[model samples]
Target: MSKLFTSYDLSGVMLSNRVVMAPMTRTRTPSNTANELTALYYAQRASAGLLITEGLPISEEGRGYLYTPGLYTDEHTHAWKEVTDAVHAKGGKIFAQLWHVGRMSHVSIQPGNQSPVSSGEVPATNTTVYAWTEDGKEGPVLPSVPRALRTDEVQRVTQDFVSSARRAIEAGFDGVELMAANAFVFDQFLSSSLNTRDDQYGGSIANRQRFMLETIDALAEAIGGERVGVRISPFGRLYDLQAFDGEEETWASVASALNERTLAYVHLNYQPTITAAEVPAGFGAAFRKAYRGTLIGAGGFTRELAEAELEKGDLDLFAFGTSYISNPDLVERMKNGWPLAEPDRSTFYGVIGAKGYTDYPVFDAGNESLKTVA
Candidate 1:
């Protein structure tokens, strides 16, 4: 029997299977609020053992892209409740992916037209954020220059995460995953090339890592560690994150430190095809040896590759991303060896009224035909 189809205990939460739906930014919420469409989209694909929501900004300042929802404020909480309720109705478990886009922002999106904050004053050259252009149209534009965060301001960001975690639980999420990957706030601090601060949060590897660890600790204290998961990309080069000194040691230290905790799981975003930074050979085996807790490996995983890794004990859960977009019944189709429909690349994002979001048909095993579900 394949472990991919077996049940597993994620801390106290029981997952129906080992198949996870990886977080993909759909840019469907123009109002920055989860709505009936969002709820319906998730509900349609609830068969995955776990569904990680797209990056939910903790505050307006944390937002980098347009249409991605926020998780702070009472209104945001209320909006998300609909999504959680819908997912739960179908026996699906979901985790909110908390996000802060650090230096990846523009003046049009930032509150008060202030510069985006980061570990240092450096800017993400040649990088673009999906924000409003000068012509009042939503499109990609160059990110604004960023200012270095003060030491006290750094602690305040951790508090922001704690507050968001509380709201996630209030909004009925089973758990929350910290968005520490893809050159975000935490990733910016982790990169020595980007973070030049002299405070307790920069320079050496340990100092650079302090910001993320502190935020994780604060979140764990607020909402039991078992309800918290973190996503990281080792040697990731997305959004101009350059290879820094002690990169390998930094990831190893992170794995070792996380191993000491009793958290829900540590999700590794292993996308060699997406990022310019190629993971060193055998890094997965090394990381597995370092972190003994429940591990999830996402990015570019086919059913065969996922099963191979699961059988070898390299990963506990496998997250499928693109396949889940066109095939809502992904787990069932994979289990039955059914063919998958390709997703429309153009409709991958935008508030286009579900032309590609929720209109994807599910395979009808009863009659061998595809049937559309509202």
Candidate 2:
């Protein structure tokens, strides 16, 4: 059985344990840039085996919500450096998540308030991205129909991922993970249901995986493959986009390609962002067969269930989400089986700083100040 505290070697960086803080979206950044409060939040959660920063927009167009921080400009890099330095000072390993929302964004958050990008001209269905208007009310709105990215422009967008990776590296992140999942830009190109374009980037399953494959190569080029990992919600659903059964054959092809490059690890987020129905039967088992490198599984997993799953040899690591939301000392809680504090749903989406973002209590520390959950 794989214990949570035992050290593991991932991408040549020796980790003290296997507990990784999954990439979550938090609006705690200062004025759309990382600041001291954000640094304190993350530095407080530095005990996690590994840390991944919240989803940071690679470009202004990637803003899926209001007040969400980004990694585009020099100021962004400088701001994030404080976070990385703080995390490292606490003896933690951290990775930044590179994000691009594509059609999953509202026009109000974009530069000049223009339409977002998507693989096709159609708009996202059955989904809504939240944003705060001038009056500061959180409202969910449908994204405008995105202009299909031209062949030449596609490289520029991919460059955004590359540039973000470089910025993350420069910001003192030990590594970086590409947000290739969750119906984002990479997700748009990977799903057969979301991408209907007939260009070289679409059509067959191999073609569907092309953009992700190319993005991985581009990111690896920016940062070494050993320091790069990609997150995929292969069976997750949002915006009426879902990949199942043979539709995930692209994952197999892409995983194989990614494995050949010897990237750090591949993260699979297996839960539906909204409904419980997104857990495809036998999906994790199939992914274990396809991926040759380290695999991290994320979803609603309990310690007992995670132990059983790990015993099956399907996942090398388990990413606990909601459980860690208000439990900054999650690893310690796991070690002692402590009861977890409930996360407040009211403040989860685009609120402000230190409310739900940093109010989590660490059990072992005996009511230590509200801390960040990696």
Candidate 3:
């Protein structure tokens, strides 16, 4: 039997298979609240062993895009209840990915049109954020320079994460994954190039990691440590975030730190476009050795490659991003060797309706009329 189809235990949750649906941002929540459509979208892909929701802002200040969902309000928690109920009805386990955009945000999305907050006062160049104009049209716009977070305010942000995690539990999520990757708030603190603060939150490797580790501590205290997972992009340079000389040492410290926690998993996101050497050689194995917990790898992974990695024990689970977006029955397709459908890149983001959202056709060799689960 292919290892991908084998059941595995993540923390205490027993998944039916090893295929995880990686989180992808679909900007359908205009009101920053998950609704029936969001529920249907997730329930359609319940076959995945584990399904992670798109990055959800922990607070109004954490919002980076115009239409992403938030978890800081009672209304948001009530709305997400519908989504979690739908996925649970289909026997699926889901996790909420908590996010804080930091300096990657524009004032248009910030509360009261204020400047975005970050570890430092630097601006991310050649990067843009989704913004809505007066005419209600939405598109990418350049982000504004951000003010450095006050040393005392850092703890407040960590409390926001704790509150968000509690809300996620109330909304019926099986777990919560911190968005510490892709040059977001947590990543900003981890990057030596971005975090130039002199306090306990920056400067040395241990100081840079203090915020992340402290956030994890708070999250584990609110929710059990076993129910928390973290995602990190160690070598990512996206959003004008440059690679520094201490990248290896920084990540090693992170891995070693996480090893001490009874966490669920450490998710690694590999950006193929950033460099030809995707994931650098032996990176996965080295991390697995360091963390000693479940490790999930996400990128452009094929079925053959996923199987090989699982067979060799490099990855405990394989996360599919674009493939899951287009094919809701991705696990079945992989099992039956069905041809996969290509996702419509044009409709990948900022779509309002089901045109590019839930309209993807399920595989039908007989070429029958396509139908959505909902």
Candidate 4:
């Protein structure tokens, strides 16, 4: 059997395989709560060794896009229980990816129509958040200018993450993954060009990375370090983030710092197709060397590519995002070499029903039936 199909231990949790379902925001929850549909969606893809949920805002202020679920309220905890139960029933482990958009948000999405908060007073230029437009309809709109967070208030944000992680445990999640990747709250602070704060949270790379490391430590304290995971994108240019000075050194520092902690794994969102030129040479190998713990690699990975990396000892697990959308039986199909299905882009987000969400059927080699049990 291929290494990808073999069982492996993730911290203390034993997975049946090394394939992970990467979090993809489908925006199905208009009320900002998970429902039976959400349970069904995850349950269908439970074949993956582990399932990382879509970004769940730690607080209302942490939200940036509309229709995404929130993780602060008791009602939110209660709602997610169904999803967790379903995934567990199918013998899968799931992690809630806690998110705070920071400045990548619109005023309409903020509480009391307030501006979004960030490490500095900067707006994500040329980037649009999924929010209410001028006509009161949900669509893409320019992110609102944000206010710089007071130095004292930085701890409050970290507390927010701690609070949410506790709620995730109550919701029966096996673990939690911090959404430190892509241009979210931690990314806002990590980017040298974006964070101009004169406080202890900005200027130098150490200060810029302080907020993220503090939050990670707090989460580890609240929930055991064994149940925590973090996702980061080095040299990531998403959401107007620029390639700044000490870019390589900053990421190397992050890897070195994470090595000191006893976390579940470090998830690297590396895309060779889009970021090969920008990412430093041998970056993956360098990160693997710095962080000796389990490492999961995401971004356009096929079975062949993932196997190659595993052979090289660069990645412990492989994450599939878009592939999981249309192929709930992705692992089985890959293992059996079955043809894969394509997802409908139009029905990718903001959809009300199970048309594009839970309606994907599993592959049947015998051609006897094509219905999805979940």
Give the Cα lDDT of each candidate: 0.92, 0.79, 0.88, 0.92
* Superposed model 3: Cα runs more than 4 Å off: 133-137, 274-278, 365-370
- For candidate 4, the lDDT comes to 0.92
TM-score of each: 0.98, 0.92, 0.96, 0.98
In order of listing, the candidates' clash counts read 0, 0, 0, 0
lDDT of 1 by residue, 224-315 (tens): 99999999998888888889989999999999999988799999986586565788998999999999999999889998999888778989
**Least well predicted 10-residue stretch by lDDT in candidate 3:** 270-279
For candidate 4, the per-residue lDDT at 215 reads: 95
lDDT for predicted candidate 2 compared with the true structure: 0.79
- Over 156-201, each residue of candidate 4 has an lDDT whose tens digit, in order, gives 9999999999999999999999999988889889988889999899
Cα lDDT of model 3 by residue, 307-336, tens digit: 988878867988999998889989988998
Query: What residue pairs clash in candidate 3, if any at all?
Result: none
Q: After superposition, how far is residue 51 of candidate 3 from its true place, in Å?
A: 0.3
Residues 142-215, candidate 2, lDDT per residue (tens digit)?
77778778877787888988998899999999998988887788878877766778988878877777777888
Candidate 4: residue 274 lDDT (0-100) = 57
**Which scores greater on lDDT, model 2 or model 4?**
4
Q: Candidate 2: how many backbone clashes?
A: 0
